[model samples]
Target: MAARRADLRSALPGLRRTLRYLRPHLRPERWLLAGGFGCLLAEVAFRLIEPWPLKYVIDAVIEPGAADRSGIVALLLLCAVALVAAAGLRALSAYLMTVCFALAGTRAMTAVRADVFAHVQRLSLRFHGSTKTGDLLTRLVGDVGRLQEVAVTAALPLLGNVVALLGMTAVMVVLDWRLALIVVAAFPVFVLASSRSSRKITSAARLQRRREGELAGTAGETLGAITVVQAYSLERILQRVFGADNQRALRDGVKASRLAAGLERKTDLLVGVATAAVLLVGGTRVLDGALTPGELVVFVSYLKGAFKPMRDLAKYTGRLAKAAASGERIVDLLETVPDITDAPHARPAPRFRGELRFEQVDLDYGTGERALRDVSLRIPAGCRVGLVGPSGSGKSTLAALVLRLYDPTGGAVTIDGHDLRDLTLASVRGQVAVVLQESVLFATSVRENIRYGRPDATDAEVEAAARVAHADEFVRRLEYGYDTVLGERGTGLSGGQRQRVAVARAVLRDARIVVLDEAATGLDRESSAAVRDAIRALTRGRTTLVISHVPEEVADCDVVVRLEAGRVVEYRPRALPRRGETVDARRR
Candidate 1:
């Protein structure tokens, strides 16, 4: 018991944070909530008067010898008035409460979604590089949806019921203490059952939710890369993995559902038993002449009303468990501090002279494997530096450092005289543009994809960028020219065309520094030459870094650097061998 209490106490902070997200709606809807409360109070007042009508009708009209027609009529009229008042007040409270909670739920949903998006954006590239895209999507969509369900179905209703339960219980005790004792005694059993079931179901639900996220991520990854699966013929293997995940989720869900159902059944049974006890004991009081028959009816009605909240609480248990799972996941993400963040006093880097220098930089991914070891190099402004190496030779790693994708494990990479780490990350990144081997384009128009580089760019600016990238002629041939919609990841476009669109995007950015990693990998000879020409046009007067495996592009660069075994092997200006001299002789 103590351990469970401690666990709940620990979760209190997260609950408070989740509730805080609802603050905006709470402040604005105070008047609506106040109106709702007013309606509730009126309903309670009318119920209190409900018993009086019965008492008067029985004692004055039917029970006593003075059973006058006019008196009976008056009592009937009073009873009708009480019923009408209660019905109106009940309807008003229900409507207002629903509206208020709905607004609050929507506000929480918006805040949580925004927090997840902003947090994902700020997280380190390494974090994103390693995390499954589907898992993040599940957090943003599925888990957030669970939270919304909790806010609407459980959180708000639970609050209202708790208040109503306390008020109703107090009134029952004041009206008749002995009958109230019967309810009070049974209440503890209901609370105990609720708490125990909630803890078990909530724990299982949290695990289920995590597994579901993994399942979603797996599905998303496979669907996105269905071509790879087909090429590799791994569909059966992936299906088995997905099946196992689904089976585990199913087992957990079944366990939670059975447990919640048992609690609900037990609560209902208790309500039945409590009603029986109230009737038996209250019947004795009425026969003993201590209570009137009409009073017994009212007391039974109040007992039923009190149990109504407890019955509804049983229904909310499952919803609360689901919400608790979502709450924990959201809290875990929101509380995680990013590995990379802006320095307290970071400033924008001064206009880069484009002097790139790596001073004995060493990097490790903490998995006992070094990606770069004691690497050193310098490239002056307006120079084309080519990085060439076999696979796993740190060629890509070097390019990532230039983009500040990951801070070096040791040493410093400087732009001009400023340490890249000391400059604000956004400022450094804003000035550097990267075009990778596979450029990702959205399911949108060509103009929109190019405009992604500079959202505020005018149409003229976008057209100019496309022209510089050598993509204007083809773009003009499209059905809507630049306005033609492209498929997801630029699916409808040809390989070279897609690459050119990517180049156009980078060209539009017009950053002072550019990094091209196998940027022309998929293009044919003609398209490759066109892309290379476009790249030359883009990189003029900018510090450019190219990671290449081909001799043609490497030969065009002003300086070539080679990497082997995570260390730079050579750095020199490229020149044709002397006439009648063998190139192999120079390598020795």
Candidate 2:
């Protein structure tokens, strides 16, 4: 018993947190909830009145000669009216309760889902790289959805049932104290039974929820990488994995179901025994002239009404357990603090000249291997520099530092003499733009994809940027022109076309600092030429840092920094002519 109490105490915080999600939404719907509760009270009052009319009818029948035949007829009519009125009020109250709670629950869950999504987006790349997308999706969508069910479907009805049970119990006691005592005695037994089974039900439910998460993860991972799966003929292996997870979920679900069914049956048996005992004791009193038959009939009706909530509560035990598990998972997620957040005193950065400097910067990926060690470099305002290196040579890491994707472990990166850490993350990131090798595009219209970089860009501006990137011709030839919707990740477009769109986006951003991380590395010859033309347009007046393995791609840059094994091995400065000089003269 002590252990059970301790467990319940531990569970309360999770329940409280889950309920907190509803508080903000409930304020606006307070009146609706109050009205629903008022209706519930009226329904209970009607139910109590209902049994009295039946009692009058029974009394009228028992003593026909005590009153006129018309009196009996009137009593019977009253009974029928009371029954109909109670039924109508109950239906009305139930409808109000369902609608009010459903609305509030839906709004609360929607807000929570949006917050979780925003939080996920704000989390660092390290968190995302380590966490599975499938697991996060399950938490964001599935777990949140289950919480809604608990708040709306199970919780509302449970509340109403509890009120009804208490009301019915009071009415039963008033009708006949002796019979009420017999009914009340069974309450503790029910409580004990429920308590004993609760821990087991909760454990099973938690296991089932975990299995469900695994199943969702397996499905998402498999489908997300379907192309790779098929190319490698991993269909059978993935199928086997999915099947195993599905079977475990199924087994756990069945176990939870069985426990719930057993709990409900036990409740039924206990209620049945109590009802029989009440009938036996009350019938004897009625026969002995100590109680009227009409009173005994009322007692039986009240008894059933009072125990209905107990039975319903028993049935809902499994659902509540599952909801509790989901709630715990949600709380765990919401409680996680983001690894990277702006300091309290951080200020927005002003427009920069884009002089970037890394002073004794060090980066350790927490894997015992240092990615960058005491590396320092400087790029003057509006200067174009090429970062050349073999694979795993910290070239991309340097670019990431410029974007503030990950802060250096041991040193500071400054932009125009302002430390990156002291500047607001948003302000710093807004001034820098990147065009990666694999450009990511949403499943949207071409015009919208271009406008994503600058949401308020006009149609003319978008078109001009696309033309500069040489993507306007193909876009115009599409079925819907700029409004043509692409598939996920721009699936319908070739790699070159995608790269051009990305370039158009970067052109639209018009940031001061631009990083090209192997942007033209994977393009075919014709595509490469088009993209190179676009790059030339993009870097016309920007501070550009080009990371590449190809020497020719960096040949025109004024300076080149080459790194090997996390150390700068070479720094070469070319005597190139100033901007606007002829290409031949600059080369000379």
Candidate 3:
């Protein structure tokens, strides 16, 4: 009993947190909620009124001395018609109640899902780097969807049943407080049975939800790498791992079901005992003339109506618990604080002159390894600079700071004499264009993918960017030309083709500062040349930062900065290449 109490105490906080997340969303749904609850109350009233018609019909049949033959027939007809009317009205009220709640519930939950998605998108790269894509997706889609489904299917009806139970019980007490006491006497046992089983079911359901998320994560990871899996012939290995998690989820689901079933049977037993007791006592009273037969019949009907909710609670407990678990998961995600956000007084950045500087900056990712230490350098506006270093030498880290992907632990990074932190993140990132080694492309049309760089770009602008990236020819050759939709991650295109598309996206961005991080590393000689031509066009008058180890890729730079162990070891200047000179000249 103490353990049950403790569990309940622990769960209350999580339940309250879930409600907090729901509150704001519920505001927009207030009118719909009001109508739904009003209908629910009307339905309960109709239920209470429903049993009385049967009571009147029985009384009319048993009491002939009170009326003439024609009068009795007229009363009977009225009673019969009243019963039908009450039943029909009650059903209509229920239908309206269900529709209203379903609409409100679905809309509120959808808004919540959208909010979570937008929050996750705005979170820092560090958060995304540490989180699993599949788990986040489950929270966004699966968990939120579960909340909506259960709200409509299980929660609303259960709420109506509860209200009806209360109304019927009150009516029973007024009719015969004695029989109502008998029914009420069985309540404590029902409470005990349900409370214990409900907690257990909730625990099991929470575990089940987590395991399901893990199952999704595992499947997503494997499917994303199925080509590699087949190449390495490790299909059996991954299958075994996935099967183990699947079995665990299955076990959890079964456990919750078993607990709910136990509660239901307990409810059934209690209902039987209460009903038997009521019939015994009420029958004796009827014989003693303390109550009329019709009244006893009404008491019994109300008793059944009241116990029905207990049975329903037993039946729907597991589903409610799962919804609760899903709600808590969503709240947990919503409560997560993003590491980066706009400063309270931050303003939008102006169009930059593209001068960038790192002033004694330091970065620590909490791994006890300083990613950058006292790193300081300056790049003049519109100058082409190169960064050459061993892997993990903080070359990429420095580039990331320019875009405010991470803030320095100490010191500051500035763009055009303004600290990056002083500017709105959107404005800061908007003015910088980046093309990485393994650039990511979406499963979208060629024109749309390029337009992603600038969402409002026109068709002519997209085509122009494509031509500059040397991607226009191949894109035109696709089945639908520029309108062709590629596969996931742009899988239908080869590496070089994908890279070129990414370059086109960067080209369409038209930012004053460009970062090329090994953008041409893995391409074939011909493809590399084409991409280089595109890069040259894209960075001609912009401030360009090139990170590469290739001699020719950085040979035409005005400066080359080298780093070792998170510190700048060398900063050297090279004569600027003449107009129309190829970078290949330096390699030769």
Candidate 4:
């Protein structure tokens, strides 16, 4: 009982939060909702009237009445017509209610899904790194979908049933107070059963949702890395892991279903008991001089009508619990404060001259380990600097700092003497472009891919940028030239070709600062030469930071900064090495 009370307390907050997602969307659809509710009232009225026809037939037409025998056939026909009219009106009202509620629910959930998706995108890399993509997807898609079900299906129907229940109860009381009391007496038992079973059903549903998320995450991770799985021959291992989670979800679902079934059966038993009691008592009253046969029939009909809502309420309890769980998860996600956000006074950065500086910077990745410590470096505008370091020597961390993907735990990074933290993130990022080791391209036309760098760029400008990056030659040779569509991650293109497209994109952006991180690391001899030429063109007049493990790759830099243990061990200008020179360097 205590646990059940605790669950109830928690559910109030969850329901309130979910209603926040619903309330704003209701404004636009207020009239529609009102109309739907009006239809519900009409449907309830029809139901109340529907039982009246039988009552009239029993009392006026079928009773021993010698005076009304002349119009008996007409009276019977009128009752049948009233029955059919009530049925037709009920069907029409039901259709209107369903359509209106569905529209409202769909639009509201869609808005929430969009907001969640956009918020997830804006969340920092740190959060994404710690979170699973599959779980996020499930929350964005499946969980939000459940909220819609709650609104359109469970919530709306439960509301209509409550109204109907109340109407029927009032009518029953008016017809015969004694019979109404007998029916109402069973309600407390129903409520008690529902309250107890609801907590169990809710607990089971929460477990089921959690297990489903885990199962989705496992499947997504396994399938996304299928190549690695195949190479490692871990298919059987992955299958077992997925199967175990699936089994757990199945168990939770079955438990919830079992609880719901038990509650329903209990409700049925109570309703049957109530019905039998009403029959025995009302039958005696009918034989007495107090109650008419028509009045007793009306009381029975109202009794059943009232109990119908109770049955529906019992059935919808499990769905409401599931939606509440999903709502809580969504609320938790939305409430997560981002680690990085712009200050109130942060301003848009003016056009950058790209004098990048790191002053006594430190980066702790929250694991009690520093990725960079007191790393300070300066690169003059238009100067090409090469950052030479082994893996985990804080080279990429420095670039990320400049990009504001992360803020330093200590000290600051500045561009054009303005601290990056004082600038709007969009303004800061707009002036910087990066070409990672593995060039990322969307599944789109070559022209569209290049235009992604500058959405408003003209076709001619795109072609010109492609030419500058030396991508024009190959792009034109494709089956459809610049309009040719590429597969996922630019699968149709070679490593060097993809890199050139990335360069083309950067060239179109025309950002003053460029960071090339191991951009030529995995290319063959011929591909390396082409990529190197493209990099030269890209860095012609831009302040460039080239990160490479190979000493030869950085031989032409105006200055080379070698980092060891997150500290700059060496910084000096170096002349370009000869083509055949074998320059050796130690890893960090």
> On residues 1-588, what C-alpha lDDT tens digit does candidate 3 reach at each position?
221233244245556777788989989999999999999999999888887877877777787477577887898888889989989989999999999999998889889999999999888888888777878888899999988998888868877877887788788888889888898777767766677678898899899999988889889889989999999999999999999999999999999999889888888988998999999999999889888888999999888988877777778778878888888999988888887788998899999988887888999976799999898887778888899989999889889999898999998899989998899999999999999998888888878888999999999999999999999999999999999998888978888888889989999999999999999998899888888988998998898999998878889998888888889888777964345322211110
Per-residue lDDT of 278-309 in model 2, one digit per residue for the tens? 98999898888877888888888888888877
> lDDT by residue for model 1 over 376-446, one digit each (tens)?
77677767778899999999898888778788999899988798888898788878888888888999999
Error of 2 at 262 (Å): 1.4
Candidate 1 Cα errors over 4 Å, as ranges: 1-17, 20-62, 575-588
Give each model's whole-structure lDDT.
0.78, 0.83, 0.85, 0.85
The alpha-carbon lDDT assigned to residue 487 of candidate 3 equals 88
Candidate 2 off by > 4 Å: 1-11, 64-67, 576-588
Taking the candidates one at a time, how many backbone clashes does each contain? 0, 0, 0, 0
For model 2 the TM-score comes to 0.93
Model 4: how far residue 393 lies from native, Å: 1.4
Rank candidates, TM-score, best first: 3, 4, 2, 1
lDDT tens string, model 4, 146-258?
98988788878877877888898888888789888998888767766677788888888888888888888898899878889999999999999999999999999999889
The best candidate by lDDT is 3
Off by over 4 Å in 3: 1-11, 64-73, 576-588
lDDT at 375 for candidate 2? 86
Pairs of colliding residues, candidate 3 = none
How much is the lDDT of residue 80 in candidate 4? 94
Global CA lDDT computed for model 3: 0.85
